[model samples]
Target: MRTSPFGRTALSFGFFLLPLFCRGSHSARNQTANVTLDASFVVVEEYAFGIQGVWVQHREPTNCTQSPEKPRTRDITPAQCNRTCFPGSFQPPRLSDCNKIIESLLNNNTGSLQANPHTWVYVYYESCVAVFENPDEDSPTLQYNWAVLGANVKSLVNSCLSTPDQNSIGGACVFDEYDGKQLSNVEVAVQRFTDFDDDHDDDE
Candidate 1:
């Protein structure tokens, strides 16, 4: 894996300062690109369970590369990630009305609550929609269930109800736990690759 210039610094100090920076930005509705998808995901995840700070990450196709080997891991604010490869749009509700929006989005799918077609990058949500949209695929692992959305909503609500004070919602609390878990795993893998490359250069 290839590491961007921001990776090492991020590994050094990003996690510790995350909450502070996140708190500074109440909403990403108008912010250009100072927040990253990963960080914004954290902010939105927190907001879902009634925590504050909602940040969104918007990226153009050119901001990210499709290749897995040359992954872009940056420590800078989302605005500075000119060459970062991870791309997506993440919109979270404001802190004041997060609960209301969450409730509506999860419980009342009155066509008004449809996921953003252009921004719905999370695979689990897409897969659930796909199972409904394309019955001909005959996906063995994912059966077509009309109650899929309800089930996910129930699970997320239960998680929030169980632990409202937990600063970070664990894996089970997310719309799709796998998305966070997979992203985390990829970050770790990228870090290890960076370490290996550094060691190799030192030896040479």
Candidate 2:
């Protein structure tokens, strides 16, 4: 299936992250506003999604006595592993409002907010990365095809996070280092999570 520019598989995920493009900050826009953000007081722990959106490093189970260099792959029936989990399938942290998150960031003027672009990109991508669990939606192939998913995520990041020109909403957003083969290593790593046997035949 052709995915959305935001890599959300044409699902609700696109809608969920929609506010990213709206405006910088209402406080920043309104000159008379009395609000001021204190980045120093902002606790990293308060950002539940940011802290939890981590990928668990894969390890061979102790039950497996064999060489981990040649790990086993699942031949799960369609009924068992019926669906692939899109990034949207996994529950986002207790974050009920993206606006609140934005407002909080806007208010912060201390050390925490110093790395704006890097911070923005980091949390944004990690929120999506949190959905990399095994798929719950049915797929003809295994859900962990790193090439496919990584490519899709990259597309989504570019589509959703990039800033657009104010006068031309449809015009291209500014390009960055995220383009091209940047996801190659990610794809290679994700291949380990799937049952993709290139030589296996239908008869096998």
lDDT of 1 by residue, 1-204 (tens): 212212333334322111112122234332332222322422212112112221212111212222324322222111110111111122111122223323433443332211111111111110010101101111111211213333443443334322334222111211111322212211110111110111112110
Q: Model 2, range 3-103, lDDT digits (tens) per residue?
A: 11222333333332211211122222211221222222121111222222222211111122323253323221111111222333323222212222333
On the 0 to 100 scale, the lDDT of residue 131 in model 1 is 8
lDDT of 2: 0.22
Q: TM-score for every candidate vs. truth?
A: 0.25, 0.21
Runs of candidate 2 exceeding 4 Å displacement: 1-54, 57-130, 133-143, 164-204
Candidate 1 wrongly placed segments (more than 4 Å): 1-61, 64-98, 107-151, 164-204
> What lDDT does the true structure give each of the candidates?
0.21, 0.22
> What TM-score would you give candidate 2 relative to the actual structure?
0.21
